[model samples]
Target: MSTKINELSVVDADKFTVSRTITIAAPIEKVWAAVTEAQHIARWFPEHATLSPLAVGTTGVFGWSDHGDFPVRIEELDPPHMIAYRWGNSNAAASTLESGETTVFRFTLETVDAGTQLTVVESGFDALRDPAASMDGNRGGWDFELDELVAYLEGSE
Candidate 1:
């Protein structure tokens, strides 16, 4: 649970996407809880998240600022291993259209030598009219978010 951003693994850029993986020094269950639980999510993710853990048709909002919320619809859930969702596209009270499109985000977790390996992938941006903005924005956002997550998991927050 180091705050050293440099230590995280950077997912190589794909055609129209960016991704990253970070190994948290915690067991898979602990890492999973930190990610899937609403209370734990708020500690690291956006300050406000409304989560529903149903196997199908579950949705929630991420982010706590005026920046607008991203609608998260669970597309796949595999216990302590994988959680895939469609992020962006809204039914939330308030939201935005930064190009009037949405992307698929997948969080894959696994147990490693000393902790859990979490990989985050967000794709489907070729449809975004503003390619530069979309890629840059998400990349920067992920970096900051991961930094915060590391701190939160380490109890530094």
Candidate 2:
């Protein structure tokens, strides 16, 4: 058997930007709710999330249904439109870098004829304490997570 791992985008490249678009067959409202609401988010993004959707700074902790916890700070919010945040990768702690050095994650919702066009962009990673190994792992991880988002929206387990 071969012992090689697949990468999605590369984590420690000179550039740091990862963006993807997924069209959901539901209305913008549904997609927005799935992303904003704590319960809805828990269903797709995390297993549990404590969210404060007020007009000010909101925050929450998202973790896997069984393991992991990533604290998120809401930077911007607009109903059925956009939600931006600073996402701290809890799993990043496993590495030798500062876990607090977060990468920005943004999710925008647009009403399209096909439904809602959700765009996700993550950036801010010029350097990693452990460049070579970490980059590949992170790149692959994000790709898998994005695929999970699609499956979650598709209501497929």
Candidate 3:
């Protein structure tokens, strides 16, 4: 794994966003699958996931045993490069695909000499109920989850 792990934080608290860029010591394709494929994502991200035949408008659910299930929809896709999903807030456990205001979290991958550079930008927290609390929850979320991704890929876990 790359010794250089970048720590990212909210770009603008008023705007309600979280952004981070990290380099993983792995091929772009490997990183791509981890972020785009449900099965791979479940290993590092949510405890369980369900999605296949990936594409824009694809619907799926990401669940954490303690956090509850969150329904998500792929809002954008650019194969092996970038993908974005609109998901319900953690504060809204009952929120569904159509029921609540959602945030869009995007993952972008690029190949570098060392490995793959992944950047994540999650926005629209301002739209959710208890936006401050939601933003605060996710501020720590990307840190924990992305570290898991790094550990899973780097075989550190």
Instruction: Give the winner by TM-score.
Output: 3
Residue lDDT tens for model 3, 1-157: 5798567656568778888888899999999999989989999999999987798998999999998888889999998999999998766645776655788999999999879999999998777777788887787888889988989988897
TM-score of 1: 0.83
Clashing pairs in 3: none
Error of 2 at 132 (Å): 6.1
Cα RMSDs, all models = 3.8, 6.6, 1.4
The alpha-carbon deviation from the true structure for residue 102 of candidate 3, after best TM-score superposition, in angstroms, is 0.8
How much is 110 displaced in model 1, in angstroms?
A: 1.2
Ranking by TM-score: 3, 1, 2
What lDDT tens digits, residue by residue, belong to model 1 across residues 1-157? 5533444334334577768888777789888887788788888888898887646568887876767667777878898998877777332223433444777778899998857778898777765666556777778778888777767777776
TM-scores vs. true structure, each candidate: 0.83, 0.74, 0.94
CA deviation > 4 Å runs, candidate 2: 1-12, 54-56, 65-67, 90-100, 127-135
Estimate every model's Cα lDDT from 0 to 1: 0.72, 0.65, 0.86
For candidate 3, the TM-score is: 0.94
Q: Ten residues in a row with the worst lDDT in model 2?
A: 1-10
Per-candidate clashes, comma-separated: 0, 0, 0
Q: Tell me the TM-score of model 2.
A: 0.74
lDDT at 6 for candidate 1?
Answer: 42
